[model samples]
Target: MITLNNKKPVNIYDPAYDKLFENLQGNILKGHGRNFTSHIFLRFEENKKDKVKKWIASFANEITSCKKQIKENLAFKRDRTSGDTFIGFYISALGYSFLENFNSSEKETDFFGSMKDANISDIKPSDWESGFREDIHAMILVADDNLMLLREKEISIRKEMNGKCKIVKIENGNVIRNEDGAGVEHFGYADGISQPLFFSDEIQELETKYKDVKINFSSFFPLSQVLVEDPFLKNEEAFGSYLVFRKLEQDVDGFKAKEEKIASIVGRKTDDEKEEIGAIIVGRFEDGTPHILSHEEGIIDNLSNNFLHKNSSNGKCLFLNHIQATNQRDEASREMIMARRGIPYGIFPGEGREVGLLFMSFQSDIKKQFEATQIQANHYKDLIIGQNLPQKMNLDCFGKKGKEINVENFVKLRGGEYFFAPSIPYLKNV
Candidate 1:
């Protein structure tokens, strides 16, 4: 049995976690590191539960495990030639109800509810895309570095589901990188910089790299933050995680135009000065520089995730900024952090195109982690990505104060769902 302390970080490389890692699915502990992804939403045909179960059991053999993913990641880091495809399978609460014979009382409460009824602030099912309005039983995530290979894999899966299931929607995602090769969202801000670290080696690498800098923030987290016992599997090592997927479309033209307008209103005259306003709103510059540490973009190292909002009360980082509003840099905020493995989708240099992020986050609890953070962000009106209706923001950074500017409707939620990425053992046995 794997022992864990609530306050201590779980060492994923330890021998005690061997069975857990073997049984757990990939892309949960860490990212799959693929450039292209296809989200295949599936709905099994009526009275086809037995066929669906058999197909899933056979397909589970293709899903990557945490142990194999770690090895692949290390091999890529050493020689940079690993180009294998990764796959993940997730079942919604409605999906489970259709397949399993268990009672409602035996089900996980949060996993059984649909995202349409989630009641997240500012999210309305009426505003969602039509594809998400239908009943979605399960999703198959296929990702790869090669576009051709990714497409081939998607076709193979589609062909396999011929009469057993219907494809509800297929959302394709591609990684958009900046000139510096760092991953960025459609809005031009660096994405997925701040994350929870589970492995000891990853934590050690960061500590060693930032040895000179006085690191105050801790990214290390226990496995319990993301993993929960699989209700369908009896194995002691069987575990699963809750996945929240949202297709957030960005209005590039509107956001950039209003960003400049807000900058001008904040009394910024020069181009460099105007850039700081965007930084204040995003809590990071376009080039991923932490605005709390440096006023200029690309001036400081981009991987600096060690700063705290408590120390920035002097107005270096605005209290209403995206990062500060979502994460208050307190002990309570630590529990709200989720493993974000989202990727950008649609046309780049977005000009009236469906381009945005396929926001995917894995956590142990949706209510405590994702929903709570969204509520907190809504309360503070996080200007960049908060879903709440647009409101005036206080421009209290960069030696300026008392200037309130209104910027509205930059990011819109198209559609999404809540899913449980079950253990490989459970899938095989079912």
Candidate 2:
């Protein structure tokens, strides 16, 4: 827990791989806040298991002899492992407190507000199943055997300890390809499709280069729905970005049943066609095209996401999809985008609450990206999840997916929180 440059020590709780987890914890203490940098990714290799154990001992020893009579605390743990890859993360109370103060803005440039809008206070880390905690949006993925050993060599071991375990990391497009899952979550409906563009110095330079181009408010101030301006840093201070980690209790079986029922009612045809049902209701196909245009013309294109279609009779895609609903494709103005990094969590046991996905997101503005979806889910029943108004929704299509959805008893929002994910540098200093 030593300070570096007067900065707080970052507690790394990733346990995707057990060995990596123990290694990270030990290294944090031995390195004394020197090794674990913020916003940077780390990878632990299997061959380096011994190296990781030594590092864990170093941190455990420090905690054992801590002079302050350290108070015992409860933390979240996620136990996901591949043969070679395991994924997990953790958050300290100090980090959790930062999440509590995160405020959402009413709109971009609307800096002043009398009171906070949403009440995510009731949301609790306790709501998570067992081994999970709120974490920053970006993740560290490692498959390199050498870097894994290199990580171990960096650890400074002081003593030996137990609680040592090993885990593996799973490799998927989520980490490498920007668009993973063909536009859906692991449970399926394309996600991260619509994200708020950050108003970084680099973005500003781009604005300058394109004179005729207009960076919409949403682009500059992504997640306007939940952008909270820090009073201390009011106008110029770099605004804190909020991350909401939710361990929602989802009824996957129930969800699947409803999806099937909707499909039958919509007169869906092939299995592939059934798969497309989710996309239809969501508006954008997995490949990111409007179903109306994609199926009708039998065409698919990722770039089609950028092609703005008029919201008229000839509109290529329906407006209900996650991408279109919040992106403000043909609206009077553009809305902010919050990058959603959510996954389904829960097990499919006989009765108890199953767990999966450590749902997460990063937003300069939360109100637009996050809140807009909430509004749609509550009002329209998140058409993607087969949740929508019984008959009021305009689900007029050939497929049963969007055509005849009950709209009632669809996706439910259990609980959630607002967190701030700081940069690597910020983590070291904070």
lDDT of 2 by residue, 1-430 (tens): 1111212222323222222222222111111111111111122233454554344334333321111111111111133211221222222222233322343242224321111235322234445323333232222221212335324422321112122322211211222112442433434444454443332442454456555544332233322333333322323222234555444444556656765765677666577667666665566555556564565312653333444545335534354454445444544324434555454433232466553344555544455555555555445345433233355554464322343344444344443344443222222222
Show the lowest summed lDDT stretch of 10 residues, model 1: 3-12
Top lDDT hit? 1
Model 1 bad stretches (over 4 Å): 4-13, 102-112, 390-404
lDDT of 1 by residue, 1-430 (tens): 6743346655656788888888999999899999999999989898888888888898999999998898898889899977479999999888888888654346756365678777667568877898888888899999999999999999998988888899999999999988989899988888898898888888888889988887788888888889888877777888999999999888888878877887677667898888887787788888878888887887687355768877865447576688888888898998899999999998675546778889999999998998888888887777656777555666665455777666586788888898999999999988
Give the per-residue Cα lDDT of candidate 1 at 367.
87
- Most TM-score-accurate candidate: 1
Over the full model, what C-alpha lDDT does candidate 2 score relative to the true structure? 0.37
Q: What TM-score against the true fold does each predicted structure earn?
A: 0.94, 0.49
